[model samples]
Target: MSLSFDVFWSFRSPYSYLVTKRLVRLVEEWDVTAVIRPVRPLAVRTPDHFVRMDPLWRPYLFLDTKRTADYLGLPFARPRPDPIIQDPQTNVIAAEQPYIQNLTHLGIAACRMGRGLAYIDHVGSMLWDGTVVGWDQGDHLARAAAAAGLDHDRLQAMVDDDRDGCEAELQANEAALRAAGHWGVPTFVFEGEPFFGQDHLDVLLWRLRRHGTARRSSGEAVDG
Candidate 1:
């Protein structure tokens, strides 16, 4: 049987966006399966997470993520209309979060269809590639869904019809992440070992290779 790893991810995390393409490459290159588990962002999972974070943390994260993106040769930008609705000055989270809720639910639906990685790769690029403004507007998400081989209208309908079910799944994903010994997005867990950041990806790859992860047959083109 092929090895599988659990990916705990969030739509609001730039780190999650940054790690996705490489992850796509990993799944394509190795005979492994990614068990994509979409989780709510730290801000949502623990409302006080950002509130209690060190004052310098946000700025450092901004600087580091951009530098990391440059190092990886991927376009980077702070998402416009940042996914989490919070006061930049106060770091106070909002009560109603329509954007994140929608995106997370769609992520759940995509994962159900076995295209979760592709969905995130496409949608994450849209939000973090410094190219789009007002990412939630018009048919932006629909186009992204299409690019990931999903039907946006259908996914939306599924979410609309079973919002509670989706929330339950997200909660389960959050619990699994915590159980895996980490609270961060883009965490990849293999055999109960948690790799908690984009920087840890090389370590995760090393571990996977050590476990004898096989290469895909040459000429097998990777999917987007």
Candidate 2:
């Protein structure tokens, strides 16, 4: 049997967006499966995740995330309208959020259809690539969904009707992530070990290699 890892991901995390560029490669180039477990970003989950964060943290994150995107040659833009509605001055989050809930639910539905990883790569690019003015609007998500081989209509239908189950799944994911010894998105948990951050993908690859995790056949295309 092949090895699999749990990806604790959040749509609101730039790191989650940044990491998937290589993550897509990881799955394609190696022998492994990534199970996507979408979690509510802390802004939506606790409302204070960013508010209570260090004063210098948010600014540095913005600077770092954009530059990192450039470093990786990935397209990126600050989310227009932002995922969670918040007061920039006070970091006070609002209660009536429309975007994140819909996105997270569809993400869960994608996982159910076994296309979660692809959906994230495609859809996350739309959300973070700064190419689309409103990533959630019009044909943006639809195109992303199609690129990932998901039926957005059906996914939304499932999300609309299965609120309780989706929340339960997200809650379970959060609990499992905490149990794995981290409370961060973009965490890859393999064989009960938690590898956190975009920087950890290489280390995770090292561990996978050392442990005899499967490799692609010769000349199979690392980026394929």
Candidate 3:
């Protein structure tokens, strides 16, 4: 009866990065299973939708995300290559794939290799710590993936080529995230309730603790 949660994450969203950082610790300290389910950010999924948003909303998001990060004791900085958007041609040439494909697969691979937490820690720290500008540059993600005992070259090749295997896994993650009732990044699902944003981690943790305790009191077995 171990409590498990699915984190629908997106690398492009600063909130997602913050959520990853905190969730890594919660998973370890609480001895709960975290299913890292990555998906494309809303910007990519519906660029026109974002473009049509009230202009004030865009700037407000940046300010709000930074303020939230400060409150959480996490680093906050705008990533280099700011918008993270690609033109149709460049996007297609880059295989037009979501960054989540690589990240989620790496998480899954790490779990398979018994290094899931390690993988989350290294990669999430680098991405969210606000140290690097262009976090997607060469060797950044690759090095983190390597730390998880994965073959960085093979993973990159699969991601770059947009291999069907990789695409399929990402598609599954997207489906799962959507089914969990959120199309946004940093959404954490517990008992079928979607808690959106890093700001909600505290609530998510409370839920996890309550669930774990209730199960334990009921004489239910817990799994690691």
Candidate 4:
């Protein structure tokens, strides 16, 4: 038997990057598949969200993400050219986002091509790992695409040709996400059950075990 789930993910969430690794491991060790649903960050989707957020929310999130990254040995840092250009003083997300649209489109294209998780691992690592400055410059994206077993030029061409189609699909993904009773990224839905957040991986695994998610024939769990 095989198992699978839908992952509602965003390009800007640190938690999404953290969960991608674990999701990859699950699929590699078990007879499972991850249906990727790429979504926009809340800051972009609902611009007023930040203004209404509690003052402590941003700071607490920063502190928690750093702590978690350290524990997992994953290098963490803010993107050099942030996907969303926000006003630091007011926490207002800019109306014109130059980066996220392109990145999200490419991610969607990868998912359409059936290698979404691989693409997420490759690209998400570069952004979250904190070492690549000007990540969108030079061959950074091209290299990441290649690493994920996707053709950089080919994906880019698809994105350029059908931007509207891609956006429509992404909009549908958001609808499905909300219908699942969660708006956050990294939400995994299995058998109509929603498992949200990185901390819930163990819980998700427990549920999978109960339902008999098939493991590798060799029966060893390896972190990829």
Best by lDDT: 1
TM-score-wise, the better of 1 and 3 is 1
Cα error, residue 190 of model 1, in Å, equals 0.7
Better of 1 and 4 by lDDT: 1
User: For every model shown, what is its TM-score relative to the native structure?
Assistant: 0.95, 0.93, 0.77, 0.95
RMSD of 2: 2.4
Instruction: Give one digit per residue, the lDDT tens place, for model 3 in 172-224.
Output: 87788788887888888887899987779989878877776232333322211
Note the clash tally of each candidate. 0, 0, 0, 0
lDDT (10s digit) by residue, model 4, range 1-224: 66777888888999999888878888778876778888988899889999999999999999999999898888899877887789998998888886998888999999988888889888998888888899989998899999999998999999999999999988998888888888887898888788999888878888888888778886443321
Off by over 4 Å in 1: 218-224
Best by the TM-score measure: 1
Q: What is the lDDT of candidate 4?
A: 0.86
* TM-score for predicted model 3 compared with the true structure: 0.77
lDDT of each: 0.88, 0.84, 0.66, 0.86
- What is the lDDT ranking, best to worst? 1, 4, 2, 3
Clashing pairs for model 3 are none
Candidate 2 lDDT trough over 10 residues, lowest sum: 215-224
lDDT (Cα, tens digit) per residue for candidate 2, span 59-156: 89889998999999988887776877889899888888778878888899898887898888888888888888877678888899999988888889
Q: Model 1, residue 46: displacement in angstroms?
A: 1.0
